[model samples]
Target chain A: MRNQNTNILKATIKDIIVAFICIAIIFFTIYIVWGSEISLAISLVNKISIDTSKKVLEEVKLNSVTNKLESYPEYGTKYGTIKIDAINADLPLYYGDTLAILRNGVGQFSGGYFPGEGGTVVCMAHNSTKYLRELAKVTPGNKIIITTNYGEFTYEVFDTTIVPQTEMEALKIQNEEEMLVLYTCYPFNSIGHTTSRYITYSKLVDSKYF
Target chain B: MVKNIVSYIITMFLILFIIMIIVLNVFSNTILKKEYTIANLKTGNYYERINQNIVDGFKDYTVQSGLSDEVLEKIYSQDKLEQDINSMIESLYTGSKINIDTESIKENLLNNIEIELEKENKEIAQSEEEALTNYMEAIVEVYKNNVLYSEKVVEEIGTVLNKANNIINKAQIVIYLIPLVLVIILIVINHKQLKFLQYIGIGLLATGLFSITPKIISELKMDINNIMAINQATSNLIQTIAQDILNRFTVIGIIMIVIGIILIIIHNVKACRILEETKRSRH
Candidate 1:
């Protein structure tokens, strides 16, 4: 009877062990599968956010031109016509920059402007099929003639400065005579947003072209 | 002596099994749940911080453009929108408490922008062309900066959320597997407990079935609204699922105890029958 009871007890223990093994296998398999699903869900959420942001940006761009057209008349007189020979050229002009119309239809102006007031008018045109690259070769004393419908404005570059991006306040509008500042990203052929803006300050030498 | 030894071993096995169950349940329900919840809460807090950063950054941008209450309100609204998204995501991951749609938020934000732009455009049209152009330029500046800031915040939130999910998954696997392995060892050491084996199997099956039942029901009842209401609702659903799993374990525990009692009764009856047969043979 003692031996029989021992045998029964041992058998029961084995049965419990086997049951645990089965449970373990099932539980682990479920856990891994569920865990993977959760990970996939997270990835999905990220993708959705990125995709939505892109869509919104695209929509904003599409509406910008129309919005600008509706509000164009109040800002300034049609002082002069600015032209860029490059196809699909979209040149945005901030008021405080200068426009320099060069020979051969090439133009370069001060790229940086003051935030609030009209200080310098930077005008840019295509050089080698790019908007700002050709200005890289421009040196001091280069003549930038601006022919406004009212009058012709000519400026000669008197100073040049290589400034960091953060010193953008240096490009602020000055209170004295209208100063023309021309700039572009330095070291032509470099990729990415221009690290440094090449600045040239010029004064109105002549308004004969107008 | 042999009978005493066997009885001791059997008692030890039973005690171990009970202990293992208790440990697993406690870890799963309290420790693991708390870890995941804390992780989720931290993620939400980080999201809020990032949103605040974006708002602060935008306020600076607006200050540069010329400060306006309208711009401040717009920033506030955008911040609120971020909060809404964070809350929704939290709900989806942690519990089924609230439902919110990402699409609706997107639509609302877009409509708000459109309305503001239209109103500004109309005003500019009525005014001088120069003023309108200047106003448009300012709007363009604000919109561009806002978009850039929003994108960064979204990306950061995604990164944090991914980390949290990974942590939760790993915890689930580890916690669930440990008790299961322990139970297997218990069974292997007590080979005479065949009835216990059957009981444990039934217990696990019942637990799994109950745990997953609500999820299955939810899936069956899923609607388009759930997809759109993906943020807070998703977190809430996950929390609800966790609770369901905890409840299932409780049920499993009770069932195992009852089965153990029945097994003990059966074992006693079998012993009595064997003794009677022996007595008759001796006579």
Candidate 2:
């Protein structure tokens, strides 16, 4: 009886081992036949799986040698606040000019430069009451202060005008001088679509880098 | 021992055959079936989410366009939304040209804008004509992009889906026939000692483990909940489909394992009974 029981136990163990071996052999065969294709499929799926676990946005950095930024804030993220005492306006500033970014506060044109980069810093905001409703009221000599994570910049309004919304030349992005070009949809209180942009041009009057 | 080895080899083949069947059936029921994907999208509220996205997107444009919220109202009705979405999905399965019609939307938007302009007693000056056209085009683009998320890739995906569907349909008959032949061979080889039941059970057990392995590895290596896409709606759709497939795999694997264990237990009992009879006859 003891011998029979031992034999039965051994047979059961052998059956399980054989089962596992069979599985390994099947997988091995598949790997040999279609390993590259399987790898390609996995890699394709992995492309869409982003690692949001780590921080990707960093503080804006100015390179004194090139008069350009060594680092820039991630697009769509708030990097600073724009305050205009003349209009009682203070709003978050984002790096991108997407409509979504503009809805939140003010969006800086990605094609333009940062505050300390000695070039045009183009920004735009919605004309709603919560935002730049009093932007048109801002006149020459009014100060627009941009407080960024890296520095504080003050620009004095020198000119204001309404331009056709399609006028790209109105936004002069050059390295000759540090300028701030801010704009919003014109006819601020209108109940319908407006095809004009109310723009305010300012020259950098002060800068304090930290 | 040689006979025993042959039986083991036969059982191995049975396991492979069973795996193929499970895979084919899973694909046929889930990935290959257009209805399954459509059902998943409906259950996930994909259409409603897309509608909300469209509304929010329009609202964003309104901020910079100096347009009131009224211009966007009723641009596309919910019924139209459903129709377009369903039609797009049909195209995906049929490998048809994917075109989300935005002409009606553009016309409706133009009509709405005209009405707004008339109410405000404002006319588009010659200088502003280009801006107005650009604005209209931009709004239409937002609608088109939102309605058909990733349009170019979608066309490629449609082609792939159609090809896969065709291949699965053509290969299905052979997929079903192979396992039947393998099971018959397994029975013929192991029937003398009534060991076919044990071998079949072993095959089932192996198949169950193999079927469930992907879910196990995915759980360990991936954060399925954090699976993302170009936008939130697409992300939610992907996660929903992935979770559903994984759940199905787990359920099928558990069911096979239970059945396999029961068969093995029954075979052991029968073998014990036959052994006892032989012992009694010898005495």
Candidate 3:
């Protein structure tokens, strides 16, 4: 004889279909309300907060007086903008000299002094026309301007030297001058690689001295 | 009814996304893991690639390996020494098997010195062989100490790779099958109207193709040298391994897409038979 109670899974196909549709509706509602929408809302909130914090930091930089900036800037981090009116060369300056860093803008050597520190400040950039290609023509008595969050400094080129890259002694400070020594690979417009460096030596002309 | 339709469409999209996520998770856990990478290095053609890299960078290797300039002077010219090393490494693999042939290195060194001596048209001093032997011994000793000192590392990698490979192979089944079972359950629950199966089948097919995205992206040319800024040999090894992993993923994606299409066809044919049976019963 048949059992008095029916098995739970025993149902008409129609009944099961209705249950399936109901489950789908529940799942859809749950995801739309709590899953994707919630994540989107959270990301939007984070974006706004991050933007405001960045702006405040930028303001702090603009108003910084003769205080010292970080002695070491992290790699690929944009700390200042550099412009040389002589070559009309304008670009962002990063602290590290990885090939990638040089591609986007000038790369400052971490071992040197900042703009107003009164020691030799050394920097480098790619030898491309877009970068320091005009560096080939930067003669003595031309101006190189550096603008950072703290202050601005201008360097008037006094000497140009083409030396073997191994001879970086020219970059060293010989006296108490806030010097800006910038260099790039020599034969700046060469088809292939060159083993020399074209260097520009300039003493700090003026600054909101730090 | 419209709400139901909206619910149905949203659920379909959710199911599609879930399937994609689960498959990608499986890939991340298995293929992209360090264990898998280490295993791939050990078990694949990476060793040969490494050998080629070593040859291409022989001078740098000599300096980095701390071989003194005096010792380098004794070993013929730099280019000649480089050739000898390249030849030794070129004979490293026999078909698919790798025998580093490190044992034959001393013999190879003697042969090279003889070739170099002949090139200079030099008369052999009876003491020349002994002097050459001394230099050979120094070079071989340094090579073994510096380069082949990673036996412990290799052993550890072998153990880990074997364990991970086994787990990944088994988990591969679970990756696709769990989603398949979920789809089947839903299909059976809504058996009266199997139209949703058509959409789910297509979703599975799309998810399968998505599984091979790493391979697809790698084929695109982009200058990303800085992010991978490292020694050339190491970077080359990473690029090769990434390519290998993506190729494996492409095959997996193709397999999943085939299974999906088959499932959809079977469901549609079954639905047709059911519809015909209902009509027959009504008559």
Give the residue spans of candidate 1 off by over 4 A: A1-9, A20-210, B1-47, B56-283
Ranking by lDDT, best first?
2, 3, 1
Q: Summarize candidate 1's per-residue lDDT along B44-130 as a digit string, tens digits.
A: 454454455444543332322222325334433555545554554454345433333334433443345446557665332332344
Candidate 3, B174-230: lDDT as tens digits:
656665666665566555656555545555555555555545544453222222413
Once superposed on the true structure, which residue ranges of model 3 sit more than 4 Å away at CA? A1-67, A70-73, A173-175, B1-283
- Fraction of true contacts reproduced, model 1? 0.01
lDDT tens string, model 1, A29-127?
Answer: 656879687556645544443222233211111122221111211121222433223223334332222121231232332343221112465543322
**Segments of candidate 2 deviating more than 4 angstroms:** A1-10, A51-75, A109-122, A127-140, A149-151, A157-204, A207-210, B96-101, B272-283
Error of 3 at B61 (Å): 22
Write one digit per residue (lDDT tens) for candidate 2, span B39-129: 9878889889888888888888776665677888888889888887887788777866666778888899889989988998888667566
Docking class of 1: incorrect
lDDT score of residue A87 within candidate 1: 27
Q: Score the docking of each candidate (DockQ).
A: 0.02, 0.32, 0.03
Query: What TM-score, computed on C-alpha atoms, does each candidate reach?
Result: 0.28, 0.84, 0.37
